[model samples]
Every structure is written in C-alpha cells, then in structure tokens.
Target: MTINLTEYGLKQTIQKTITATEQPRLGRVIEQHRELYQLITATGQRQAQVTGKLAHQATSATAFPAVGDWVLFSAGDDYTTLIDRILPRQSVLARGAVNQHDGQIIATNIDTIFICMSLNADFNVRRVERYLTIAWDSGAMPVLVLTKADVCTDRADKLRALADVTVGVPTVMCSAETGEGLEDLQPYLTAGQTVAFVGSSGVGKSTLINRLLGATVLATKTIRQDDDKGRHTTTSRQLLPLPSGACVIDTPGMRELQIFVGDLQQTFAEITALAADCKFNDCTHTSEPGCAVQAAVADGRVSLERLQSYQKLQREMSYQGLNSRQLEQAKIQRMFGGKQAMKRVKQRYHRD
Candidate 1:
C-alpha cells in the first residue's frame, strides 16, 4: 500500500530533494528501539537498521535516526532495510540526559508538543516551567495539558496558580475518563500536523493518547495509591496516525527533565521585561537597589519563586554551555597533539 508522504508532514524542501532512484528508498521512522527502527515507506512498514558508515560517523546519539525522522534506505529481500542517511529536520524536541551533559533527542519534526502534568500529586509549577524552556527551544508550540481533572477538587485554584507561570502558553484541563476539554485541542490537531505527548511517567500521558486515539493502542498503568506516583508503561517511542489525518507520538514517561539548551529570556519573558526597566544596565536582580525584578517581587507583582526558577534555569544553561565549549577545545587539542607528534617523528628521521 502506497502512503502519501505529505500526510506525514513532508514539506516541499524535502520533496524537492527526493530522487527517482530504486536503490535508496525514502521513509519516515515510526518506531525506534535501542539500535533498530521501524519505518513507514510508500511500500509499507519495514524493520530497518542504520548502515555501518552512519553509525561509525555519528559522534553522539543525537546524530542517529530518531522517531519521526525521515530517512533514506535500501530494502533487502528478507523483509529488512538498511538506512543510509537522515534528512534534515524542521524541528526537534530534546532534553538533557540524566547524569550526563549530553542532549537526548525525544522527537523530531514535531509541530506541537503537549506537556502533560496531572492535577493530582504529580503537579509542580517549577517542573512545568522547566518543560516550557525546552519546548520553546524546540521550535514547536507547547501546550500544557493538566490531566486527571476529575480527581482534583481545586481546579479553579490550580488554574489561577498556573496562570502566573504559563504566560502566553495555552493550558487544557482534560479528563480521559470524562472526555472533557479534549475538544479544545482541535486547533492543534489539524491534518498533516505531528504532536508529541511528553511528561514524567504516571502523568496519564498514555491514557490521554488512548482517549485521543479512541482505542487502547498504548499500554497504561495506574499510579500507586499511597504516594500517587506512576510506573513506566510506554517503554519506547512510537508514532501513530489518526483517522483525522494528524500524527501523534507517544513517549515513555521521563524520570528527569534536564534542559539541553533553550532561549532563557523567551521562557521567562516577564522577568526579562522587568529587568529591562532596571536603572542599571547590568542589574543582576539580586538585592540591587535599582533592580526592577526585585522591586516587582517586593510589591507582589511577580512571585519570588518564579524569579528563582528563572535564575536557576539560567545558571544551568550557562554551566552547560561552558562545558560544551570546553569539550570542543579538548577535542581540538587532541587533534593538534597528534599532528605535532607526527611532525616530530619526521624531524627525527631527517636528523638521523
């Protein structure tokens, strides 16, 4: 069965690059295991593995093919495929890997991202801010989805509290059981658009996807009754196409969400705008007499907690940026050292 590439969000730029060659076939990666992939091609879905050259040339995990990536490959007679190269992506959503200073790719070529948080015990404004920072950096629109609304009693109060932190971003209160607030998401679910559902495990991400899919296509688990914490259900990422012509990618619940890189000022626009009004050009907003941000906190215009979250994310980004630069410098030094050693060997040979 031939599939329409445009329905999977293929753009003219990529369409123009497609060649009428038989050896290399074009397809979109719909599933990814540790080292294997499942691609949806014009012919049909096929299991694929990257070519040795691609694996050898990859410097990091991000260079490899991820779910939602378009790749070129060659098909084998035994129902296997060999991927050659990945096409350029229009947008990608990623976060910092746990216990590492490297970026972890979550989904690529995404148009929208649903940052899920349960109204139950899993809700945290600070965590939502963290997700927002990474989402903004991903070049995709972020929508906050507050799930399990039926269980929460203080819905209005919680929404009021989130209003201060979720500035400019849309928030949808949804209940998979009751089917409330799901229609509000229609604007983002237009045909040809791809959206990803991401949040910590047990936040009802899979449940919401099941509701949207109108089927129990993804596995889901209940949270512990005592602490209200969730267990891992969806172990890998998979892209599913809906009858509405939109695509949804469901990912495993993340235990930790570290920022890889993002536009800090954009995420905290309110704080940045206040800083612009400070009397000093370089006010740090930390006890400075002319700090407008501090003044706002003093007058109850901005919450101290929000300002602190902004500062904390700013520090993390700065530290990571410095580490990345240092890593590059060390790599360059190693390369130059090898050249110097080879030059010394030549000099010794001439002298002898």
Candidate 2:
C-alpha cells in the first residue's frame, strides 16, 4: 500500500516508500500474557519482539512498543519482523515500574485515563493523588471514575470528595451493575480516540470496561466484604476496540503504583501555586514569616492536613529520588552519587 510522508516531514514520495517486504498495518496488541507480544496484524496475528539494534536500545521493556502502539514491520510466514520505528505517540500513560526505580510506559496514544477507584474500602485520597501524579506525567488528560456507585451510600458526597482531590480534572461516578454514568464517559471515547483504565484491585476497572463494551468482554470479581479489595481478574494489559469506534486498554489491577522521583512539582500544582505567594523566597511554610501556605491553612483556604500530605509526598519523592546505591549509603555518605546526585553536588559547589 502507498503511504504519504508529507505530514510526517519525510521527503520521499508515497509510492516509493511502499516496499514489498515491509507493509503498513493497523494492529492492536491482543495479549501481553507472555513476555512476547501478540500483535493483531492485517494478514493475521503474529507474536513479535524487538531484536538486533532495537533490542539493545530497549533498556527496559517500556522502551519497546506497548499495547495501542501503531508500528511498521516486515511480515513473514513464520517469524514476524522487528518493528523498524514507532509512530509518534499522541499521548502516553505511564507510571513507576513495580520495584524498579524507573518509569514504565503503561500505554501509548491514550486520549484519556480512567482513574478508577472503589466507593467502599479502597477509597483513598492519597491513592488518587498518586494516580493523578502519574497521569499528569504521562501527558494524557485524566478523568476520575468512581466505581461501585450502586453499593455506596451518599454518592454525591463521594463525587465531591473526588472533586476536592482532583481540583481541575473531570470526575464521574458510575456503576457497572446499574450502568450509571456511562453516557457521561462517551464523549471521550469517540472514534479513533484511545482510553486506559488504571487503579488498584477491586476498584471495578474491569467491570467498568465490560459495561462500556456493552458485553462481558472483561472478567469481574467480587470484593471481599470485610476489606473491600477486589480479587484481581485481569492479569495482563490488553487493548479492546469498542463497537462505538474508540479503543480502550485494560490493565492488571496494580497492588503498588510507585512514583518516579522527578514528577513531584507537576503533581501538586496547588501546593506549588501557594509556594509562589510566600513572602520569603526560601520559605519552608512550617513557621516562616509571611508563609502563604501556612496562612492558607490558618484562614481555611487550604487544609492543614492537605499541606501535611503535600509535605509528606514531597519528602517521599525526595527519598525515592536519592542517588545512592542503597538507603544506608545515602545516609552515611550524605552524598547521592548517581547522575542526578552528581548534578546536585555540582550545583551546590558552584552556588555562591
């Protein structure tokens, strides 16, 4: 098939770019069940991986193509060709990898992120904060989706709580059982758009997907009555196309969504905004004169607990961002020595 390169800034003509061995294909990742990915090619589905120079460049699994990525590769009878290049992503949804110090690309070209949370036992402002931080870092617009609305009491109260946490992002309350709030979510799932759902187990992520698909495409699990945590039903991240024309990727329920060290400033915009108003240029907001943040807490403009939460998150991020090989090394040496650590050291030395 002939392809145009004018939009992408290539000088080659459309017909010349089409090669016999290499073909352009629109493929969605059917399964990430194994280390190898099952890509749904036009001719048929094929198991593919990065090899040769590409494999060497992929420092982490996330560096390779992810589910929802449209790539160009050579087709074969037995073996699928390595993806030569990844098309520019419209958006990316990522989070800190489990137990790893780096970020993991959850999905690419996502238009919106459904920040799922349960109405019952798993409800947490802190968890939502983490999800928002990661979502903002991913460069995708985030929408808060509260599931199990049918079972929760005072549903309006829950929405208000999410609104307070999100501040600027959209929030919707929905239940798979009753199919509530599905219509509110439709505008974001228009044709050619992509969406991703992420949250801890028992937050009804799968249930919400099943409802949007208008069928039981994704498995559902019941939350424990005592603790309100749902058993994980989806084990791998898979992209599913909706009959309505959009695409959605369902991910495994995350037990621990760690934070990468550098996103602290972007995640808490409110706190950052308050800091700009402080009288002292280096005010810590604890008891500094003309502290805008502390003054906000005193005047009820901001909650004390909210400031405390912000401070706690900042500290956690600092700890995670330490450059030492180990926590003990950071404590004893008092100098983190990784690339970031060295940069800090140089900055301090050079400062007047």
Candidate 3:
C-alpha cells in the first residue's frame, strides 16, 4: 500500500517550506531512538540521522527533530537517510524536569492533546487544571479523556467536581475494556489530524490508544487495584498512523508534569474575566481591596482552593531557576532563531 504524505499530516503549510535546492527526500519522523530517527516516507519506514552540520548547529535537544516532525532528508548507502532540517512546527508539546534545565520536546505538529485521567484512583481535578493550563498554551485544542469509566461509581459527583476547572475544555469518558463511550473519541480521530494521548501512569493511555488502533500495537500494564500508580508500558514517544488516516502520537505517562510555560488565561477563564472588573489592572487577587477575584471567592463564584492552585502554578513556572520570562525568551529563540540570536542577546547585555 502506498503511503500518502498528506494523509500523514503533510499539510500545505509545511509543504510550502520545502525548497527545490536541498530537499531530495521528505518524510515524517515516527520515532526517535537516541540519535537514530525512524521516518515513514512515500516508500515505507526508514532509519535516519541528522547531518553533522545540523547536529553541530543545534543549541539544545528541543532544536533537534522530535516525533511528529516533518523533516527533509537525503538518501544514503544501505537504505539509510540523513536528515537536513526540521520543518517549522505548527504546535509543540513540551515539559520541564527538576534536574534538567532545558524543556523536553515530547511531540510536535499535533492537532489535539488528549489529557487522560482515570476515574477510579487516579482522578485529580487539580492535576486536570495543570494539564489544561499547559494544553491551552500548546496551540492545539485540549480534550480531557476520562479513562476507566467502567468501574467508576461516583461518575456524576466527580464530573461535577471537574466542571468548574475544565470550563470550555471538551471531556469524554471511555472504558478500554467495555468499549463504552469509545465512539466519542472518533470525532477527533478523523483523517489528517494528529492527536496525542498524554496523562499520568496507569490511567489507561496505551489501553485506550490500543482500542483506537483496533489492535494492541502498544503494550499495557495492569494497574494495581489499590493506588493507580502502575507503570506505563510505552517507554518512549512514537507517532503511529491510524487505520482511519489520522495519526496518533503515543507518549510515556508523565506523573508529575513540570510546566515550562502555561496559558492560565484559558484554564482560569472565570477568574480572568473577574479580574477585568478589579480596581487595579495588576491585581494579584490576594487581599487587595476591590479585588474582583477575591470578591468572587468571597461570594463563592470561584473556589478559594482553585484560586490558590492558579497562583501556585503562576509561581511554579520558574522552571529550573530561570524566570518565566527567560524561559519564554529561550523558547522563542529555539522556535525562530539559533546561535545568532543568543549571541545578539549577550552582545546587547555586554554593551550595557
């Protein structure tokens, strides 16, 4: 069967980036195992690596090709390929680590981000808020996938709890075993769209993806009935083409999501709207008089706990000792420029 690049998310916007001079081969990176990249071209799956110049020019790991990235490559001996450059990504999903300073690029050019959470022992509305914050900033739509719906006894209560925090975000409940509510996921899985499954461990990310794939392409580990801390079977990120013509990027479960940047405006829409009525434009919503957010909290319009959670996330965005502004500037440099921009910053600072 011939693989159609358009159906694999090679949209016209990305196709316009190709130049007649350098691009001899075009393919999407399906998986990156260390330095070797696995790409699916018009022919089939092929192994590839970045050119020495490309590798040398990269300033950080995120500058390299990630899964779901379209790349220009050249054919080599023994059927191997050498990647020349990565196309501009429409959307990027990344996370930060405590010990690690740079943000890790998990996937790129995705259409939707499925934030999975099991209803049984893994449900946390706070975590859902955190995920929504990160998702709203990703330039992709975020959908909350509530897994393990079959065994949940307090579905209504839990959903009611989540209603306030997940405002405007789509939520779906499905059971991988019973197949209930599985059809709800089909709308987002249409052709040419690439959706990613992401959540903490044992929330049934792989299981739900397997159900969507119509086969167990990924391994699943049974969750312990006690605390839903089961390990994920998929150890790395991989982009798989679904039979329906859409692509699915399966990622390893992230228990503690360290956010590099977030869009709290969408996640805390109610508070953001309330802040408009505040007497001060820069109201922190703490104890200031005429603070609209605090006033809303007093009248129960917004929960104090949720307000505090939002503030905590605001303070927590200082990833790896860099202020949020620094991290954002770093991201801008990674996305649009390279060593030249970094050098310019240093030169401007040194001149001052």
Using lDDT as the measure, which candidate wins? 3
What are the per-residue Cα lDDT tens digits for candidate 3 across 1-352?
5677877877766665665553347899999899999998877888999988889988777889999998888866766689987766778887776776567787889999999999987889999988888788778899999999998999999999998987788899999999999899889989899999899988999988888888988999998867767776889899887888889999998879987667888999998899999999878899788998998898998999999999988887744356668767765654544545456545544554
lDDT of 2: 0.69
Superposed by TM-score, candidate 1 places the C-alpha of residue 156 at a distance from the truth, in angstroms, of: 1.0
lDDT per residue (tens digit) for residues 246-305 in model 1: 899999898777777666677788898999999997787897788899999999999999
lDDT of 2 by residue, 143-237 (tens): 99988888899777767666556877888888888988888999988876678999998799988888888889888878887877789998888
Best by TM-score: 3
TM-score of each: 0.86, 0.79, 0.89
How many collisions per candidate?
0, 1, 0
Q: Each candidate's lDDT (Cα)?
A: 0.82, 0.69, 0.84
Backbone clashes (count) for model 2: 1
After superposition, candidate 3 runs with Cα above 4 Å error: 20-24, 76-80, 319-352
Report the C-alpha displacement of residue 198, candidate 1, in angstroms: 0.6
Per-residue error for 67 in candidate 1, Å, reads: 0.8
lDDT leaderboard ranking? 3, 1, 2
RMSD of 2: 9.1
